[model samples]
Target: MAVPTVPRLGPQIGTRLMRRFSSCPRAYSYADTLPNLKIGAHTRVLFQGFTGRQATANVKESLEWGTKIVGGVKPGVEGEHLGLPIFPSVKVAQEKAKPDASAIYVPGNQTADAIEEAIEAEIPLVVAVAEHVPIHDILRIHSMLQTQSKTRLVGANCPGIISAIGKCRIGFQPLPCFAPGHVGIVAKSGTLSYETVASTTRAGLGQSLCISMGGDVLAGTNFVDALKVFEHDDDTQGIIIVGEIGGAAEMDAAEWIKDYRRRTTDPKPIMALIGGLEAPTGRVMGHAGAWTAPGEPDAQTKYRALEQAGVVMVNHPEKFGHGMRTLLARSLSKSGTSNTLFGNGLQKRGYHATRRTTLASIVGYQQKRSLYLKEAQALEILKLKSVPVAEGDIGSNGLICISIDRSALSPCIVASSDPESDPRLLRRIPFSYGQATVENHPMMADLADQLKIPSSSRDQLGSIVQALWEIFKEKEAFVLECQIGVSADGTFAAHGARFGFDDAAYRSSGRQEEIHRLRNTSEEVPEEVEAEKYGIVYVKLQGQGSIGTLVNGAGLAMNTVDALTFHGGHCANFLDTGGKATSETVKASFQIICSDPRVKAIFVNIFGGLTRCDMIAEGIILAFRDLHMQVPVVVRLRGTNEELGQQMIAESGLPLHAFDSFEDAAKKVISLAGPQ
Candidate 1:
């Protein structure tokens, strides 16, 4: 998630390579001489299964494009061929040619082996051009790459990576379509990648690095991984991400980009184009991994997600080049800079420099002044200042004390009066907890402005509180414990007082005790401990004895809740099993719902995507048999083996009711629950 900053631009290479190249004048001079060197310029590649006809043609084309294909690997062809040395294996090739990178043109069945050989040989980068590799084998190859941590894999069914600036081709991508420039392209489809590169080059906005991340069910490298690489490549100032429908990789990339922008002062601009806009559901479009399931992200969903994350969504693949050009042009124009490709455009856009504070400064300030005010003194000062005091008695410790009516309070405080309502008082109070310094003064203030004072005038109390806030604003003299909250019966309750914002003090005080009491007595569940513990999310509703609802996916869960609520039925809790639900997880979810004494009926609604519906039905049967629950259970299953799941539920011979329609299930569950 943490992206390393691109090396600073200087006479030498960017900061990333400065440590190694700074010591070598020849390297620096070579870089200085070229200036447009791509990210993989130093990469020396060895081909796996090099003696094959396909490998020979691709390697020859790559060599003709000025790529550094140092050597090749074949089981028996271990000598020199086509002016390049061939070895028995990657390890042997490595010792002889000392290749730092590798490309695989081996058959689908042998693709995993080739990749494994490259990884074992410690080749830093491996690109697999073979297609139709088994999912399990790809998984193993991905696991190996992860365990090694040093090697980066590009594809199983991909066009591979091309560095136009470096004149290097590691995959099967046609070299004639690319040109060296500042823009970088990361794509999921092979033909789409070519189209992107061709269009960008046509627009005279050539690319620095163009990577086709492969069209496998689980790509070894995802959009986020490629984005990180582009983020740190000095040669790439603008980027275009080409995504397809199926997985959450695009969404993940969008989230990562947002985080990256927040961490770095200046971030390179990024645009995206998601494919499969008109493609039908359940149909695999060319790529084996391009088929999307129900409730999973589609093209429009990805577009919205990326757009919300600040990535410009190009409507068409043809517009990719124009979109990037316009975006970069606007950025440069906003900064009042020329069309230079490799400068810090982010800094010019008013990105603040990183803030650094020493630990000594914090410790020294805390040590300078350490003062505590007794409760009596604190109350007396507030009383003298004409501050509105709630009807409460001063405790032995001088803290105000009042009895809390638990029945009058809600399960949770949804909204409270603004702590900083008075503009004069706001000037003295720290805006955030981080800004709270030891030097600030602690002052008594009304927690609720609605609290009435029979003895004091409102205007007089406000003036006094403002004056006190100003006096204590310069020093850490505020006692946060003097705060109050409104009871359910419309009475102001004063609790324990503590100096400053001390978490431990607040927790130990009567305020915390009241919260604990409410949680214990209230029908509402405090947190989703059980669901969260089992790696799922659950949200409890307000009323007790309501129908409990369980479903897969957030969208499905929300739809179920809305449908139940719309039909005059109350939901006891909302549980999302997510995409990878198991029988164990479903049993846990059922147990959680049944634990709520208020839940009279359990409504299980699942639309499986990656999760199988049969697994959910099995869990329901297990829960019913094990828990021996009295509550009526209503189940509705859809998508991915739903018919088998329905049959299993029917054969269970349990009192559980199964339905095909969500509406029927909701109404049936509500009717079974009866009056709540």
Candidate 2:
């Protein structure tokens, strides 16, 4: 494999290198992209959890916005509700309503079942609003739909979709904020999705479909899937994808667009809003699974990939729609959509077409129409400035070849001609190129080998060194070896800091082989480093702080957190005991909290959804027994199992204080912290 020498973007001095890459390379302007398409007004919809608070609230709002919500599916409660018939099964709902799309509001564990049921009922579009669904559930649902039903599963954990002009608001999107139009909005985050929609609408362009694909770890469908749908949908003029930090989904989508642009004469314009430039890795905000875990994917890499593929980059979301319109208008002119006259037979009909053409020719009118081409040329200029390019070479295998600069070199060694290099030091450590790019260009691989580097060079030397540093420090290979084949993050890149498990025999057996196995199995090894770092256990009720935490019986947890924050408090963490709390789990939960230094005081608030509050109380008591406590503990026990829990806590005689009302308990905790 040949590695072509590429100029590094940021400068490096001695052993220190400056990596100043931003989130993603490109941003989108929503204001520039929206168009008015002829969309239908009737889009029949059904809701699965119509009885739930969230479902009812969202449905009522959707109904007010002209959504024809024909029916709903609720177990047992099957009378007329929300002015729609309620059924027990999706089949029953589908039969009565003949709905085109459905929205779901089931719990995480049962979300897969609900979605599968909807798919079985032949619902073309389904949106799930359940969070923290198991990863296996998402995979199974997507895989089953792909093979068995061919159903379009929108989200396993998402806010849902909305078609502004069509009046087809199938998801939980707030309709009042949306207007009708041609911009297609796809986002990973719900709030960001709404922001993009509002921005586009405010910019005088309506939306075709605003799809929030859920900001979960394992998503249902990717950007390419949504793009293809938009490409086929006549109402959709362009797509504005709102992405967040994490995953290679964006870059993969960009790569797909590159291929799509190559084949299609009339290509759908794509703009992107990839968020998370300031996001810190390992610290997952919002969704639990949406964390950017180490080297998987980030915004900067995605931006670069998208820019390479010719996606128009903008800065503000408000400008995205307008930007798209400008691109489209230019595209229209390039395709000769403007009125033109020909021959003397037309008689110039009170207008001189020849004179117009003559004037255009005199000052280069055709150049005004070639925006995309001009942009591509500008990119070429930037590319040349970033890298020293060489021409193609002949190969026996019909492969193209390009080599790096090797003006002065000795046999079996490449040397850097630096003034500071000593006579002896100059004889060793040859200079090498670590990065190259080739679109099925054969010369790249040959050039890589000549440069004494690998063929999978994705960026210039700075990036390559970064990847290498990460691999060395992290003791993990900088490569993603899929089942189909092997692909490196890049050749000659620095590695990430190693987890403790990387030092194990499994990793040492062969980094590449271990990575392949890990990728294939989707299994994670135990890293003592993380365990050691976050070993202490701490437990608290949903109370004041950021990162609102929750478990089963989300209503109770939510209420508790709400009350806590209402009293000038915030829930720093949410820990749900689910149905029942075990002593071991209680201890483990406490340890998790103790591991977090941000937690000052602890609140154990529970309103037993299924199991009694007494069990949770007992678990907390036992946790204090086994784990030595250093922080003040406040407990709020109510509903099912409260007596038994209180009895156990009292019997423990560990001086643990208890409370009933969440507010009172939060006040006590606030007081314990001593003012503010």
Candidate 3:
């Protein structure tokens, strides 16, 4: 088999995003890396879900690769093997032959149960090949393995691993594509890993271990977790990570590598390739974990972040070995260690070498530096106009620095640090200082940071605070009232009004008519229609309860809420965020509550299908922020840039909750307002 020398850009974003939506964080398990690429050809193995077509194909291929297949299990297919000895259960298979590991080919829905059964049988390792498993199933298996453990889980949708020269294979790949060697391969896709392994083999290099972690929203292990095993294994000299998109998992791994490299004298040379350039925008991909919701990590962005963190990026997968060899050459030269190049003269090929940093990066840096320079200049202009001053520093450290002058108090000016700045802060302050918005300033350095003004240049002073103060002094028209907030049920409540952060005597004046109505009726009987129309009733439930209802799109919503509760989150009521949603219908749906007082937090998951997110966003903003709804709402919007929807909430200046991950949004809402 040809060993892959370079890393391939594989399918990534959609899975990661799907994982985010599913609310499953990829588990980082370091112990899964086997001792060496040397798996004895005689090691016994079994198939857990052996009756399925995919499993049957993999079983045939695995046996072809020289794995000692002893038995199989398929519930009712007991005692009848598809081609091998078939047992009724994993226990029966285990009794017949002491297998070291077991491979699973169950459907996604039944994967966790299959893995759990394998674990119970004391199998050392389990490889799952089911794709699109539910998050709850992944988590259940993960939790079981973690707290009350047995076998290590490989994947529910992965290609499995190959021990190369040892000639033992567990996944679904042609074994002729790999040969044992020193380079370690860890990837998110089965096909991608095969490509890398194939390239390395062709280049005459061998693999220590080639692991194709599944691309589900929740993989059994993450890159960093797997790296720990590679680092400890004596055979691994260099490691290549093939990442795609969705979350910051790669970045998180890169950050870990930075710390790991700094701490260890003999850190392995690491290379990375991130894929997902042409990922579809609004649909969940093949893997449930591959969902790339809006604003979550994407492939290109992850690549850039990894590169900045000092990981060498290979532009072409075919050139991965070259990059690794180059880094190895540097490391070897730096250590003054004499080594011989073996297998093939692939490293000696006179291919064009590319520099990591290019002209585009330099130009981008210069642009940012210039923008910051202009901001400081503009701040100088504002100080001449009359704004108050509080000076702080960047501290040579990155933390924000600023000080507030005691005398610079106005009833309209609320401190930016105050969480509940009056919403009216918009009215008092101009949207822009010429071209800048309220987004600039805690002094002026904040403006530069917001504007992404470059920090490194003698000609560029980072003194944004001083310039802003100077500009404020000169600009009398830059009046800004504190940003606003109210109770969930629409009772007017300002931070300064309640907390008295500053002397409360200086709070912005004028209560709204709605606020007055709510405040007055807070003690008396409230007008039911008006209260129901404007305010959301919040109730907390604290008891052992099971069963949750989710209603929305035909199939998606059913799976979503069911999967959520199945994974341990208690779902009380699922209200469709769309489907002829009028203010009156919204009110009616909310009031009809056999579940309300008991329903934890309402998860309003809407993907804008036929319905525009802006309309929903607007409705939500009005119901909660302006009208003072009492319950915390968890909202997920897809199907549209939905930025317009986002912008509408931003303009209202209300603390409307929004998130790209349905899981993250659900978690946040549940934590804050779920049943007690």
- How much lDDT does each candidate structure score? 0.58, 0.49, 0.48
Candidate 1's error at 147, in angstroms? 1.7
Span of 10 residues, lowest total lDDT, candidate 2:
403-412
Best by TM-score: 2
RMSD after Cα superposition, model 1? 20.2
lDDT per residue for candidate 3 within 1-676, as digits (tens), equals 1211111211221232223222322342224334322345656778887777767777777777677888778786666665678888887778887787788877666776788677667677788876545443453344345432346677777777667655677776556556778788888754445446655765666688777666655566567657777887777777888776454567678788878877988677777666543332323222334434212344556666666566666533445665566667777677521212222312111111232332112111121100112223333333443322222221121111111111111111222332222211211111111122222333244433432334442112223233332333222211111112223443221111110011000111221222222222343323222323432221122243322232233123433343354234565533332232445544444443223456545555554433466886776666554345555555555433456766665566554466655456656656655454
* Alpha-carbon runs more than 4 Å astray in model 1: 1-39, 293-295, 335-676
lDDT score, candidate 3, position 68: 80
Total backbone clashes of model 2? 81
Q: Largest lDDT belongs to which candidate?
A: 1
TM-score of each: 0.45, 0.47, 0.46
In model 1, which range of ten residues has the least summed lDDT?
Answer: 404-413
In candidate 2, stretches whose alpha carbon ends up further than 4 angstroms from where it belongs are 1-40, 293-295, 335-676
